[model samples]
Target: MARETHIEAYDGPAGGWGSAKSVGRYVLGEGAPLRTTAALAKQNKVGGFACVSCAWSKPRDPNTFEFCENGAKATAWELTSKAIDASFFARHTLRELEHWSDFALEDQGRLTEPLKYDAASDRYLPIAWEQAFAEIGAELNAIDPKAAVFYASGRASLETSYLYQLFARIYGTNNLPDSSNMCHESTSVALPESIGVPVGTVFLEDFETTDFIFFFGQNVGSNAPRMLHPLQEARKRGVPIITFNPLRERGLERFTNPQAPTEMLTGAETTISTQYCQVKAGGDLAALFGLAKALIALDDAAAESGGPAVLDHGFIAEHTHGFEAFAGACRARGWDAIERGAGLSRAALEQAAETYARSTAAIAVYGMGLTQHRTGVENVQMLANLLLLKGNIGRPGAGICPVRGHSNVQGQRTVGITEKTKLAPLDRLKELYDFEPPREDGMATVDACEGMVAGTVEAFVALGGNFLRAIPETGAMETAWRKLRLSVQIATKLNRSHVVHGRAAYLLPCLGRIEIDRQASGPQAVSVEDSSSHFHGSRALVDPVAATLKSELAIVAGLARATLLPNPKVDWEGWTADYAKVRDAIEATYPKVFPGFNARLDTPGGFPKPIAAREREWTTPTGKANFIFPESLDENPDMPAPNPDALRLITLRSNDQFNTTIYGFDDRFRGVDGTRMVVFMNAADIARLGFADAGTVTMTTAADDALREVAGFRIVAYDIPEGCCAAYYPECNPLIPLWHHAKGSKVPAAKAIPVTLRAAG
Candidate 1:
């Protein structure tokens, strides 16, 4: 079935709405509408449920949707009243479920009964909560503590995250493989090195005041729909937004907000970016370096004219270190190198730099697109260096914003789900639970995959995630996970992981955040922090689909009780009955940081956590901000000299998709429809390959030993640079080698993949 890239036809924009509405219907199985609902019943109250979409904070203002398109989808998914009990499981075997599409499988709705995978039946059978807990404990107790690994998702609540960390520490292992290790690890590794803060310094208000916004490697419209409104507003205010991405995203060009009444009435859309530059995949580093070099030259010229220099010499000298080294590196790089590497001319780069210099405040917002490269950490540091020349960090309307994926991904890490870094929380846990926490470092996401591939890990407890499919090196991870003795998953619905069975696998159904958990102690509220570092309460608004479904807190407690430390000093039962007790433990653990956790929840907007960037505090060794020069801007290896036979391939997501989940087969913005298997290439590339437009094509892995092939793909002409092509991820994921990952974070280089195109059979 090996085939070349081909084009069937274009599916119109309005056509996809039907599909979107269809997915919406599937997600909102059975939920009634209600007005005058309490704060907890409303979607986005400080005391209500957190938006299941982007990490953008909701203002106290009631006008905004508080929910984006994706947020609405997330909320609908959570509020769905569909049920998946033992009867549903009996009707579908694990093997059969394995054959289902990701959307169809998740669409089957919420889990109800605690179930274990039956080898003979190849289906999950219902088990009592007590038995499930006993089995988990017995399995963990039999295995070496070092062999057990804890996998966490970003969807976990703050209380659950804290307790999970404590449980792992007391259990004598620090193998916390969290979602952060996959997405923003580069930001975590680089920001501290450059500007003294790992998170964004700009609050939502900063977006309103910034003069120019430089968005590098982010698709804000689809990824964070809330960003579109602000960006549109900025556009209307005549603020320039220069976008540098490998692909010319449709959302970046224009957006018609469905929420805006005027636009909807007139069928009008607001234009977003003033200038769009399509850099080569992995060429972001080069583009950034080129811009900085241009700015430095501008500064020198401005100084000669007796005008204020384009650079903030005072800020650089007072707040930062290593400016000299970075300056030297920029000065040494020639214009030819910059032009060739960045795929942009000196004039184009200067125009971009001049925009930065002229603006009162310039904010650079990025997404996983920046953090998923080989030199991702260095890339982020370079971005910081560019901003520092103009004093962008810790300013009124400027800073670096990393758009985190998953609603509470950042919050999950903030509370405690880290592998090795322990704040004063350990002592508090000791006092509250009478057990010493582990001090050793734990495995990161990359290390976990490596461990599984090496077969040292014998057990994995996945707390709500699609670990195997979500991770890279699917083949290697599957091989290693199959060697494990047990794998336990606490989830609200079915996913690929349940079918990727371990020797002893259990799928423990848990309650969603929107459901009411009426336990022994009465109703409870869970704490969730947003990306902006504001912690608030989440109370269940809807009743659980079935009475048997348990909360994650309850499930973890039952397992802990059944397994190690039968007489554990921690109030596991109390925390399960009421999550506030768990928050009390969190507050006690970090008094200076999380003091008055309960009292603060009553505030209008939850209290802000400590942000070093806000106060311009440097937590580094020198007590001053630092800057380091990356070796080069060429994030990708040099291409083979004038090889007409080779083509560079980058993976992308369709408008109808998010990560591995395909809502439908239409990408409305890209003028694509009814398909996920299309590749975009420049006209010259298609002509050079001797392929006709809209013809069938095949993509084969660049590596000689690899046999991965994506067939029946349609080739379409795009505004892309010559010799570069793009396709959807996971479908093309087989072409990405496990060994090809970022140097610092080890995340897969999905943005820069090498592949060869062929004519289809």
Candidate 2:
């Protein structure tokens, strides 16, 4: 049954009673009141499991109520009372369930036991874990090692990720495509080339000392609610907060800390953004160039007047290279081009530049909006360039922060969840496990999709993500996945991917992070690295939803034992039994970074991993941070001019959702309720396109070679840029071509799609 649609301007501040009410609804909806409360209490606690939401780091001394609204929803969703058993599968056929919405499919609840698709009945029948493992092993053994694609989700812990990569390498395949290939691969690619590391240098404490903070393309309220506390504190401290985004996000506009009883009870809210600049959907690079250009002009004028220079000349001379060429490129970018490309006036950018110039210390934060574009890598590098101009890196209260989604995603990469095979990690693995790791590069997420379409990929295995729904061009990807000879999904809940089966499909139910993991040795705690690179131990407080549900480590071990013939001398069972053993192995593999892994876990607040870039010790080829100068502002430099009638479309996430998981249809922050198929358009654009404010429309991609369209989208007039529009993803994912991705990063350019709107037939 569809709920009634409601649209109104949201006047309430973020993170107040609204968040509390949403969290309360989710907790009650889970149906196990006591258990849900207990489980939530255990989340983000000192010794309890980390929240499975965003990777925002927990406070050193976290309050009793440490979880946020999104975190609460994730917890409730995972620990829900509902269950999907063999009988539930028998009630519905694969074809019948295929038409269900992504939310409906997952809301069927936790998978209680292992299931295997029965082609005859077109249903998922119960299967023993051993039988499923044997079948998967047989299919894997039958195929060439290179034909198998092992996909990893960021939700997997460091231990599970390490074991997964080991299993893939032992099976003689380097095709390890992961969620990072779709999200922060741009940061992973660009940061290392520009600086010396792939990770951000900022710590949680950095927010306190910053004089100015700039947020680009990040909506802190929905993505990471915990971040609002610091931003609120920064506001109280009189720090200038600048925001650059296509849409006006409420979290960036103002916030009310629910934790503050006085503010929540009294209705007082903290003003967040001192200045908000609505940059065009693919225009971050141009805007950044404009900011840099304005800064350069101010510096030149200062130098001519024999006044204090705006640029950090000392930092540039000592810590960076290619400044001369980069500066020249920035200065050469004309104001007209910048204004046209960024959809911002020259005065607004200059005002932002002036605010940035006056600050002694500043931090630049960004999210998927900047990274999910054709120039995603360049967009990130440009942020780095902006920071480097005033020596933002390697200092307190200042650095580049690509606020990553998914807890432990960064940790997974830290523990070697990558398609590229580095010799150092390989050698370390060999020294620790006595196995020769593959040297060749593996397929990324896009490459794996292409491989599946080409019929070169034989098998597919996912650790914990909804692969089919998360990827771009869902129509093509769904078909490609079905063509595989074998597909395996190890997850807690049933999703769209489970119904869209391959020749032989297995659904292996695994324990969620909040559930206790009891192994042969003893109870174990898995470690995860937060976005800030702090590693902490997580132990579940609640029992598994079903006794049959296996831990991710156990499943990986079972697959390894069943598949890898004549196994090496490594003790997979021992490592799985005691996660401390896994930590020991991690220490052995990466001695310098993870030194004394077990010992470090004992330290309160966990140990912050050493970042060479933070210490200004650049290990880049130039032995210093390299400044990159792009030839053009356009993400696709060779692309044809955009259609005059076409609007730039960006896929967004509702406040009620995270990634592909929809908790509800409401996007309270944006004042959208009861629908996921609505598109946000400027009032002027709506008027120009001859559509009413709330008119229904069909959005069709303007791609020359491919025609991708989605119908029945309600157009909601919003305070957005004139020629730009926004829609929630997975629903809008069909319009983004798989081939339209960032250069070098291969991340889908979901935020820069060109689309034309027509009245619904």
Candidate 3:
């Protein structure tokens, strides 16, 4: 292939010349330097579009160059000058395009028209929007509403998301799963039970005064590079940052702000973390227990000596539940088990505890690493327990921060996109629309796949996403997708998902976030919420690439109109004509939470949504924060005994990748060049496993079936902890079974896969 593997040392600080060069290459290489350059300038700025890459909230006062390398790439990729229309689709058959990679399919450029799959010719032909919608509506009307799966990606704005979910509920199904279900569903599921809110309580501005930042799991450099600036500033202010991760991430270790003239001119690097501990894969729960245990031990010592209280007694008594049982459970877990399970020394755990105890306000930040495990829900709860020991939640510069990857993932979920029945406020929907909402639980990401495999899921409607590539068991999902009777995709561009169509499929082109959406009223602006619950308006940077393109909101409304013809309850036409009406309807549904929604859109840097947890107002059933006691130190209970010979495979994303979209094959952060078919292993493990450095090896899963495996992966010596290995995601997705997911959250346990390796023949 593209060179087996080329590993080198990447000692340079993150976000320097390397980041700048990558941004330059991507933006300039789009063949529309001026157009792409202008789009980058408008990103994250007032009255401009939000960055479609990551959901990091914007500062109250944004910089002139507020975008990061990933943001630049996403912006450039969307603002491409290339166009692929009906003629191009006619030239390429679906079977031929099935062989193309996801990146190659999207790189073909934007979908220019509504097209229907022609099974006889194995090609797609242009069709009128009304005709396509009518056909799709007819098919959906014929099937049971519960059998349809309505999926939305994070790229959808709040306006579109609201309408999209409403459409699904009105169509008689709660199968409203979105991109958030795949990534941060654990945070969403656990945080509410632990702290009475599904989202993190810390604000973007909280970084300025935070005493300590405990970063876990997430690599900010690749996922959300804009986060580095605040962390670097926190370091400059002498705030000690403690990091816990399996791989030594370059972003969490050191960062040089590319926007800072002095750093760029002098090539100066800012040390991000005071201490970095390499926690084993799927060891976050054990590590959290260790930290909590240390905190309790310190408190016990202080109590006897009449010293300053280590635990916040007043806060615990006033605003918490289950502290006694949780603390006792922590005391029972010995240091030996903690150290063994966490892959960290007692000294490191104690040091982290000390740092955490000393800080008046600390923010516990995490990403998919903590959430993508069998004990993902427990991982979040354990983290909350640690934060509660020092009363870190619901205060300025404190609490949890589960960083989101998609731009408006949290927003989409906030505006009623979920598989759960009660989360959508069915009561309000009925009161407003006078329709009976679905009460039964619906299909999530995994359930949707199972439904497809079982021939029960008749139709699949995706707003935007590479569903096949994003889901687990890629091979199985790819084949099962063909079982669907209808597959309707509303997207800005073509992707591999389009090629792997159902029995009948339709591709409807929609306007991109960067393109101006001129509805019947006038140019309309959309809104999105960041990871921190900050809501803001996003206007277009340029005109639509094609005249035939429609806004996502319009498309969803059009489909709803076709499906439920002559429905007087929902005003789909009015909502599509003017998006302000949609906002008004949203406010009508959640008035207290979204009052003056339309007027607030003009706020300079947007407004922060009200979070009950941030105000220490616990809205849980207990009316206070609750401490959770995990079942065991071993997060992966399904996993057998901890065998030293077995390797826990953790999936990673390259610096040049975003989700399933591969920008390039170069990952400067890990020193991987020109190839993604490589696995990172410790030097000792390499020798212990009897594999030479850079030698090709085949990895087979240790599951009961033992069918999941990948061959021809080069083993590169890395600095990871023993008994663990790392490889790029989506490439290794084939080895992950669809059933291997978190216990409660059902999120794919991608962080830790049991596997074994042997020399490739």
Candidate 4:
């Protein structure tokens, strides 16, 4: 049952509609089982839409057909009837769509007009959305609105990211830069510094009263496959789950639930983690300091045999403060350096601290592999010091969860699309739009890629992503997005960041929350928040192959009334055709966490935002609830001296890929069929590097001034972990280097690099 890995052609990376798999079988062909049984009977109902992939949390049930399998390839890559119009741009030519392949530039679908990027007939011409908002308000009023940045994409909406952060702070500039500054900006900078709420204290009936789930560096079966049916219904109600990851996923080891019909007619599959622990790549702060020094040696042997006292002492002495400086930094760390920096063993961290001391409602749940590392905000302050040492935040099935990966990236940071300068979101943007927003620090996707490679960025705009191929220095982000001077995006399809061009690009074309936008104050309803802080309302069930598109909240209220009007006091043209006036300006800005956010997104299973109803009270700045003692348990903060003839490499993801979406090229859980430049190795490093298990190799990098090499590669030998080795992610993202990040989430901790094999030459 392992021969089926066909790949007749699959060009990687592109706008994610469930990121590639033969462009979701050519945009969901054969009527993807009747359009996913009529769009999973309107998931999270009260108007449907949302599941454009990831950010798990739904149940507003119109009838819950419960989507998954990358939410039916993101609703068949946006109900694909594939378009691209304008005679495929009068026969392609942005240098032949830059030699087409980022999955043939989004498998040439949608996007009907509002083009621009001419650069003297290199192509893409069709303009006129009022001449693309008067040439983006004359190149953003001739730059210096803090060099015009703006970013956003977590699939926008929440009234187009609260009117594109209220037109980039009313034309001043808090830059906004998003894609959660390249993934979960460390859970909004470590759960609001440990719980005055950044987000996720757990809800979704806290997985039906959880008993233990931990999980980390999340992979949730190809990234949030409907969170593998609530961890397979909390492992069929016995609950355990565990996992930590260094790749060994299959939706965390088995899944199926094709919305169950006798488990999809007996193809049966539900297994989900009952302990998996691999932990290494940036050894999650030495596996959360070896599970807090094995729960402080099982709470000092249950207080020297006087039974009952494995911690939570009366909810950590009334909702915790600092537990004696987090139990003296987990007793100044030891136990053979936490079992040699968490490669696991203090008897498997005391069997994961006796399943977290017989959990009374545990959770943890993390993702972005624990927030793209370098101690991603000290790993969300050690999962809020293991859920406040067992009092488990706001209870009813314990908390911490992070997950989130678009689908309104936590409702575009719950309406603000941050770059963090909040004083109650700048005093609720001076009481709902009088002005005065620019308080300071903006630009965060690693300081907007070092401010577009240090040229003090000039006009980026995005709104919907694919930003320089989801950035990480792919050839210095295609030469700093061809030296932008106006890039713009607001897309619906055609990716490679719209054929890389920048010196004045545009592309516009919007509308796609599954369609039906309509406008002139009629059938709309957008919203989208997920990953627990619910929020809801989406609508659009199709129909709109371009009535001249436009509805990323009316193209951010027609480019914020062509860059903030001469007399604009926030009616950005009636909040772009009324998105309930951008939910009354995010309910006058975060009213106790978006209270009654648009009448609780018009009920029936929508609302929920307020958090930690009462637990680890911490919005940080020492309101106390922090504990992350990192000095060193080095999960390769650039591991080097390990050249016992090379072998570290890690990079993964390939159950028919998703991030950098390559849908086709069968990875069918590593029995790898078609091809993605193979390379798994570990048959004793291919018989001591003499290679032959399936021939063809070359890999490189042993550091010491070495940049990279990654030539051809075919070596097979499977079952990883010897000196470890696996590859697949931006096709080994050219053997990861862009200053090999992770020191505070610069990210690219591509598992944990090192490399060296050989044999093909």
Candidate 5:
């Protein structure tokens, strides 16, 4: 059964009565409103668990209710009154459950115990924990470690991620890939080459003192809702905000902070952006070039007039290299190419450059919009080039900010969760843990999928994620998944991944972020780093929803204990008894980043991890920040005779969605309701496609050998560029080829898939 879509215009400002009503409905709809209400009060505070939504850092001085509507929905969804046990599984077979929607599967509630898939009856039967672990460990030890893919989601804490990596390495493999591979792997890979640090330089305090803000790709209202508060404040202080996105997102245009009583009561709103540029999809690089070109031209004019220098020549000469080459490339880029690639006029880019020149300090913040392209790595480097032109990296109110999606996605990487060998401390692990860590470079997300499809990979072990839904080419991967020797899913709630099992699959229930995690010694709090590199302590105040649920830390240790032989070198049992041991091991592994790991949590907003570029000390190959030039304008890969009918399709997330989890059907700010299968196209594009006010249509992927087609999707007229169209992700993931990804980083290029649309029968 498909969801029927109803299209309408939504003129309301972001975060007003609309958000308030949504929060009320979501929180109350959880079947336990009173209990969920009590738990909501403790979210994002000093004493309570962190919001399991976006990676935005909690304020130093948090209000009574610091969580947003999306945060509330996440909490209520976790602490729901509904329950699912072996009885529920007994009632529904695997064939019957496969037909259920993602939302319906979640609505069935949390997993209670260990269950093993029975192929004979096509059902999952309750199994003993020891038997489950013994069988999984036997299978794991039986296979080549390189052939096993150990995947981690962002929802896990630093303690869990650290131990998870340690377990994988000790088991003799560096095949550790996480959710970051799909999202900001470009930032992690590109920033180090440009500025000598993978993390962002701008902190929350910078938001207060910034003179201007440049926002790109991400929709702040839906993705990082709490960011709207700072944007609103900056707007009130007269700090001009420039937004460059294909969609004139309601959050960028106007925002009414729901936390502000005066604004909420009076129905008043604040204008967020002083200017909005709807650049076409796959055009961020060209738009960035246009801005840089205008700035260079301004500097030329300033030199002729004997005026103050527009470019920071002094800083450029002292701390940066490759400026001349980068500048020459920008100069070589013609305005016609820029206009065609960026979908904006030269005058508009100049106007933006003028505003950028006027500001003493500015922060360039972007989201997945810039990262999920074939030129994703270059797109990030281009932003660094723009910021370096003004010496913005190590300044008071200027830097680059990449807004992360999950709560501790950044922290997980800091402690250890990556496929690349450079980030992991191989030398230290050998000295500290007395084991030979994997030396070879490991496989990323796409590599893992390719391995599975090629029959090179024999097992898949996931720690908290819907692997089946989150990745590209879902159908192909689903089929490849069955070929595995074993599939182990460590999760809290049951997702489609649990149902789509291998020869032998086991589901292990784990603790959620909102529930209390008490180890053998005492209650424990885990550390998580924010997008700005600040680490905070997260302690759950509410009780566990189920009696059988174990902490992720314990679960990881349990599997490690079962898999590895009785090795005196590692103490899996001791680490599970106390999480502090995990932190100690993490500090020892990366002493530079986590020197005072446990003690730093007492600080007001937690301690800031050291970033070399933040101090203007470049640790790059040249010992200086380098300006890299983009090889092309459009992010699209080189193709002979490009498809004339192709429209760049940007897969989006509904306001009610977080990753693959859908909280509800309404996309409030986007005027979308009742469906996630609609396509957003410009009014002129609708006419060009020979449709009147748009009708039901089918989309076919224009690239790759695969016959990728999604049928019965309606088209909605949006304020996007003529050649661009939009649709929700995971739904449209099948259309994107697994081979399509960022050039150097290998992140999935979901934002710039070339597609064609035709009327559906």
Candidate 6:
């Protein structure tokens, strides 16, 4: 059932009546207009729940309408009038639902009760909470603890994540793989090596004072719309924003404030980026080297001419190491190589470098575009090196900003949800909880998938998220998942992962962020850390969508109690009765970062956690920031060369999509409507490939081994770099092999896959 496809030039600003209308449509379609409106009004407000869409921090003095268009969609989706109970499952068997699209599976409505798969009828039958817990526990006890894997979603709250990690360790396995492994695992691994911290150093207020903002490989408009407000203000105050991406994102070009009635009524739009650079896919390292090369040349000329040195020698000498080696590497990079790799002329890069040299305070903000590659860690480290050259860090309006996707993805890591467990946190948990925590490192997402495929993993439990849809090389991963003895998902709605089950599967419905959770101690609140490391409390304003749904905390506790059968040490029931107890345990675990966690919620906007890089208090092994020198421009040397007709394929999210969730088929910002299977290509590339605009084509991976292909993709000619093409993910995910990923980070190299386009068969 393909809808009518319509393509129109999206000349209007990013957010305006268009956003408002989208929200209205979703809310009305879900039959929750008034409820959605009231819930949205309270979102991001004092003592209100935070938006679960993106990790953008809320303002201290909040606005009346603080939610964005996507935020409204998420809220409506969670609070929809439609419900999926035992009756609904009886109507449609798992076989029938397996053939449905991802959108259709989730749009069927929210899960209302606990379900257990009945193999005989291929349907999910209602199961009591206790029975589900007991059966899950029995399966856990039957298998070796090391054979089970616990996967956590970014949407899980800090308290729930803390409890989840604790449960995994106590059950005698450290195979904990979370969403970070798929997204910002590179940032967590690289930043600490370069700057003594894994998270970004910029605060929310830095946008107001920064002289220049460099948006490298990020789409702020669709991914984080709330950020448009700050960018808009910066534009009004004469801040120059430079964007470097393979595709020109409209969100970074112009934006109209949806919250401003006057701007909405008059159709006034604010111009965002002063310049846009379409760098080649997987060429971020080259572009970064070019900028550094330009800056180094400028500094040398300035010194020879008896002018003030352009480089921040004072800060470099005082707070950083390995400057000479790094400088040598920058000088050695040839302009020809840089230009060829970046797909940009030397003049364009130099112009951008000139802005960097002049500005005293600038922020380099990036998203997955810079991190989802084989050189992901190096990409982040190079950005740090660039900022260090100009002394941009530790200043009021300057630092590195990695805009996070899920609301609490960073927060989950802050709490104990990590594959690499530290001894200090383990000791703290042991001392407080009176149990021996596992000292061994755990398996990350990629590792866990491999373990399952090798028949080493026996059970899989997901807190949230569509694990099958989110991970790359789904064809093999799905086969491996079916080999497991037991599988469980704690979710709010039905997804592809639920239908694609193991030998025995369970679906435990949980309350969403927008729903109220009343425990023995009264209404409860959960905390989430935003992208900037700002910790705030989120409390639900409305009742739970389903009466039988349980909070994630309660579900985790139930599983813990059932699994820890003999002589269990911790009191799982006590923690679930009151969430404050969970916070107290978290404060005890990470005292410095989460000190006075319970009392801090009283503050209007939660406090920003201490960042060592922000204060020049480097906690690295050298007690100072280190400038790392890469050996060459090609980070992944083992990557096979593409065929002459091959184009670098980069997977992107549609304007109406977030991560893996599809709200609609239309990608309005890209002038795409009623379709998600379209690929954007340069007009010249299309002509060279002998393909007409709007013609159907199939994209096949051009690697040495493992042929993967996606069929029936309509070609759309657009403004993009030559030798580079873009398509939506979960659809194109098959083309990315399981072995193709960042070296150390294991994040799928989604931005730099090699593929060839051909006419549809």
Among residues 3 or more apart in sequence or in different chains, the pairs in candidate 2 whose N, CA or C atoms overlap within 3 Å are none
After superposition, which runs of candidate 1 have C-alpha atoms over 4 Å from their true positions? 1-41, 62-64, 422-432, 602-605, 637-644, 703-706
Off by over 4 Å in 2: none
| Distance from true location, Cα of 43 in model 5, Å | 1.5
In candidate 5, what are the lDDT values of residues 1-761, reduced to their tens digit?
A: 66677678899998999999999999878887887888788777776778887888788887678888888899888888877898898799988888887888888788888889999988888888878888899999999999999999898999999889988989988898889999999999999999999989998889999998999898998898888888888898999899999998898888887788998899899999898999999899999999999999999899999998899998899999999999999999999999999999998899999999888888999999999999999999999999999899899888999999898999888876888888988888789878888899888999999999999999999999899999998889999998999999998787888888899999999888888888888888887888888888888877888888888888888899899867786878888888788788888888888888887764666678998887999999999999997778979865425677779999999999999888878998888888877899999889877875658999999886679899978888888998999999889999989989999988999998999988888
- Judge candidate 6 at residue 397 and give its lDDT: 94
- Please give the lDDT score at residue 621 for candidate 5: 96
List pairs with backbone clashes in candidate 3.
none
Worst lDDT window (10 residues) for model 3? 1-10
lDDT of each candidate versus the true structure: 0.75, 0.89, 0.89, 0.72, 0.88, 0.89
lDDT of 5 at 591: 83
lDDT of 2 by residue, 517-561 (tens): 999777888888888889888888888889999999999999998
Badly placed stretches (over 4 Å) of model 3 are 1-5, 641-644
Lowest lDDT sum, 10 consecutive residues, model 4, at 9-18
**Ranking of models by lDDT:** 2, 3, 6, 5, 1, 4
Q: Write the per-residue lDDT of candidate 1 for residues 298-405, one digit (tens) a residue.
A: 888888999888898888888888888888889888889888877878888889988888987988988777787778888888888888888888888888888887
What's each prediction's TM-score?
0.93, 0.99, 0.98, 0.35, 0.98, 0.99
Candidate 2 RMSD to the correct structure: 1.1
lDDT of 5: 0.88
Query: Superposing all C-alpha atoms, what RMSD in Å does each candidate have to the true structure?
Result: 3.4, 1.1, 1.3, 23.2, 1.2, 1.2
TM-score of 5: 0.98
* Deviation (Å) of 761 in candidate 3: 1.9
Error of 4 at 742 (Å): 21
